[model samples]
Target chain A: MSTLPLISCRGLKKIYPLSGVEVHALRGVDLDIERGEMVAIMGPSGSGKSTLMNIIGCMDLQTQGSYYFDGVNTSDLDARELAALRNKKLGFVFQRYNLLPRASALYNVEIPLFYSGMYGEEVKNRALAALSRFGIDELADNLPNQLSGGQQQRVAIARAVVNDPLVVLADEPTGALDTTNSLEVMNILQKMHIEQGVTIIIITHEPEIAGFCPRKLIMRDGKIISNEISSSDVRSKEV
Target chain B: MSVRFRVLSSFSIDALKANKMRSFLTMLGVIIGVAAVILMMSIGQGAQQQVLSRINSLGSNLLTVMPGAAGQFVRSGNVNTLTLKDAQAIAKLTGVARVAPTVRGNTLATCGNKTWTTEISGTTQEIADISSLEVELGRFFSETDVAGISSVAVIGQTVYENLFDAGVDPVGSEIRLSGISFKVIGLLKSLGASSGGPDRDDTIYIPVTTAQIRLLGKTDQSVNQIQVQVQDLNQMGTVQDEITSLLRKRHRLSDQADDDFNIRNITQLQTAAQNVTGILTLFLAGVAMISLIVGGIGIMNIMLVSVTERTREIGLRMAVGANKQDILNQFLYEAILLSLTGSFFGIVFGIAGSKIFSHFAKWSTAISIQAVVLSVAFALIVGVFFGYYPARRASRLNPAEALSFE
Candidate 1:
């Protein structure tokens, strides 16, 4: 594998402005991940793990930092540029699924395609292919409210992968589910990383959830405390 | 997404449907406002037209002389200081059609066992010709009575009924105005009441010379007014100039000084009445729009609440690559859509209400195209005006805090 990183961070810091005060969310963080690497972030409450994730996901700007995504430096990028990069190079999955309440599973997956301005049968084909790959293709017409928590999570995963983004970013994707459901989500994430050769990054406090990732990183007091390589569990060569 | 209007339009429709009762209430405001404008304008227009037709009935092309500092005057009912010679001179003018000398005053008339009070006018054969006095019994006072100052008279239907004890033909019957006996020679047609319910038939007429020499004897050379008629409408300006110069020279008023008399065409009065209706309609429309403004406020309140309720949804959108402008546009689209739908229903109600009112009012009503167009535009504008603040607040939400919002 090339030594060049798909995502690189240098001296990233986040300070929030409160009334007559300032809140330091992230302090002096430096990190990187190679292309096609699967990593998990573990942190306690108020550890600024979510803040770091927001910055990395391009949903927020770092107060002081340099972030290079796929070799393009994001220091001077505007809000529009951040959204564009997030749409094309990054994907997000949340614990609550966050599918549009009025839309069906298929429509939820097609939202990324709408932003990309892909028209005609092409958007449908790509959206259907993404859902079918996750084995939720038969439930494509069901609304998020009509689906089970695990099924909704599966739909969210399909939505994340619809654009074939460079990195899949998940924030406690299985935090609201049962153990069986949690394992099912982890298994899907592992299969996508290995089979599709896509980079994956997940944020969670659970050690077992981190165990499913090929690498693990822990944060405390807004600082990364440990970074370690974990055993890659290649559960399937096909399927 | 490609064509911004279509996307925004669909979203607005959804907003309108989501709050059915609120949307209907907003529409009600618009309906009442627009309908009032139409109704007020129609009534005003109808009344003005009726007055104009009455004035025209007095003479085909009459010009009334009013007392003014100059030629500019608006009212036809005001008393003036013009006389019999002025009428004669106006008739002799190059573009003159004809002229009628008129003397009007309030007086008490009495016959045997009957006494009635009403307006009394002393006029000539020209007045009879111009006023279209139908001879229901005997002939109107002729040139003989005017020239010879005979005591012959013509009476309106209302005066004949109230003042005459002898129901027989009033022709040759005697009556006294200020105690001078005059023979009633003719009866006028029943012109009915004016729109305000004043009895137009409650009056009497006699030859100008007879009233001047016998009844309303006075040394003042000036008669009350002179009614002049032009041959055609296009000849009015020339006749007006001739009358102006004549009056100015007679009164010895210089070019720099204003004339003591004013000349007005009935057409101008008609136009002025039309303008009054137009202004009334505009004022009513302005008042009605207040309700629409209130409706817009309701929309803003609801939108603000919606933004607060969907904070986490906004955060999710931002995280999924939606920008501030996109979010702003989304809410604005909803606002415009709600208002547009309201305006549509308002138009429907306004037209229906106007139709129902016109039948009862007995007035000719026409829906103004400008009012309809302006109201719809205003409703949409109200949407944009009131819808902006909440949408801006939504777009300005902090992503981190919003995401963490429960």
Candidate 2:
């Protein structure tokens, strides 16, 4: 790994179209996330971090400025290109876990593989492998509601990373879980970063949750207020 | 397209599984519509067949030349005449097999206190052979009676029952009609009813000369109508053509002048009847197609509701890299699958309905294979057509907004 930034945004802007008005969701944003780095984005509601996370995830297009993912200029990409990038490179985890209701854990994990252009038994094998990695293979036949909140988030994470994407973008992955479940989910994200060498981004307003990431990006009033080391792990590794 | 179709079928199966009751109800609409088409076609076909058979019982090779025109009002005092000479000329033509002159009228006949009102027809022995008659008693009027104007009559089955209440031998008995007496020659076998509602077996066949001279007041006049039979059934049309032209020439009419006679061929009439029934069947099938369209609309509606319900799923799929085309393909496939399933059930229902209708309603049904194929194809097209907008709406949805929806 040459330490190339997996995701870099320059002067990003997001303007919400209201009824005969423009709501400035993000005036400008600049971000850099290197490969193998675990980053946390912290902000209060309406601080534009959600908007920033959306842009980084390629779930929504920006109104202005450029974003680069794996050296490819994302701002210039069309809708199809954005979809391809999302499937091939980025995995998403929402606060609700966002597993398809009534779908089995195996099927939930197989979703990306289904869309990843994989065919036949390969999709099933890959999905099974991904579920086993998260230790949810035993619950592969269980529905989302059948699993515990923490287990559901683990299944969601397995689903997100099944395509072996460049990054796991989790937006408050533990927001709906209890303290114990939240800790379990945070540990899962940490394992993906530390053990599997997968770059991970966690967006949250809690410093305690942000403490688990090696790097933290804090946002306030549509701007990055702090971009600094949050843990001693990355420094020790660097030395 | 294959992937699209697979996705569509899967979604349709899911919809059916999720809302089994609604899916079944939707299928009912298509079933009724398809059934209606076949039912209507069968009824029309049955009527047409009845008409054709009625004409067939009249003998396939017979042709009748009437002096009255269709759709024209006749002046009562001015009688339209078709001479017996014209009948002779037609009888001499190359394809002519037989010819008979006839006059029709009503009169009272009495034999020993048994009196009845009946039709008295004046014709020769050829009438017996051409009309497929079987003599119940005695014998038919002969050539000698026709040539010599013998006062003899052959009564039908109904005339025998009414006039012979005494159980006397009708073959040798004398009957008085219109104050004129005639010896019974023979009795005709039954021939049921004609399309005109007159009992064919109720008429009395009298020698033409005797009918003109003894019973009615016509002492000397050309025969009123002539029935010509051709050598072969197929030659009837050509013979009729020749007869018409000959009649026109005999009448010394101008080129523009309309002929005073009408030549009706039973086969031609039967063909016309068949055509009418065929058209009616097609029209019924067409009406059924409309119901199928309505059924397709039903499928579209349910699919649209399904798409709305699965908005979040759509968003999730989009996030997982499903493009607009993929989304479009998925929903479109869903629509087509629904209609195809409906079509399958519709065909089953249509056949069953037709069978039940024919048995209960006494209708005749002919289930054409083409109808099934056309119906299936139509349903699929309808699924696609009606399903298009909803599928498009689903594909056009923004992932962010959809994901946020409950």
Across all candidates, the chain A TM-score values are 0.94, 0.93
TM-score of chain B of each: 0.87, 0.88
In model 2 chain A, which range of ten residues has the least summed lDDT? Answer: A230-239
The residue-by-residue lDDT of candidate 1 on B250-276, one tens digit each, is 778877987788777777776776677
Taking the tens digit of each residue's C-alpha lDDT, what string does model 2 give over B332-392? 8777766777777777777787788779877666677767777777777777898898999
Task: Write down the lDDT of every candidate, Cα atoms only.
Answer: 0.78, 0.81
lDDT of 2 at B258: 86
Q: What is the docking quality class of candidate 1?
A: medium
My TM-score estimates for the predictions, one after another, are 0.91, 0.87
TM-score of chain B of 1: 0.87
> Which prediction has the highest TM-score against the true structure?
1
A79-147, model 2: which lDDT tens digit per residue?
Answer: 888898889899999998888786789988887776666656898899999889878899999999899
Candidate DockQ values, in order, are 0.52, 0.57
In angstroms, what RMSD does candidate 1 have relative to the true structure? 3.4
**DockQ, candidate no. 2:** 0.57
Candidate 2 ranges with C-alpha deviation above 4 Å:
A1-6, A18-22, A71-77, A195-197, A231-239, B68-81, B108-118, B157-170, B194-196, B213-224, B245-260, B286-290
- Which 10-residue window of candidate 2 chain B scores lowest in summed lDDT? B70-79
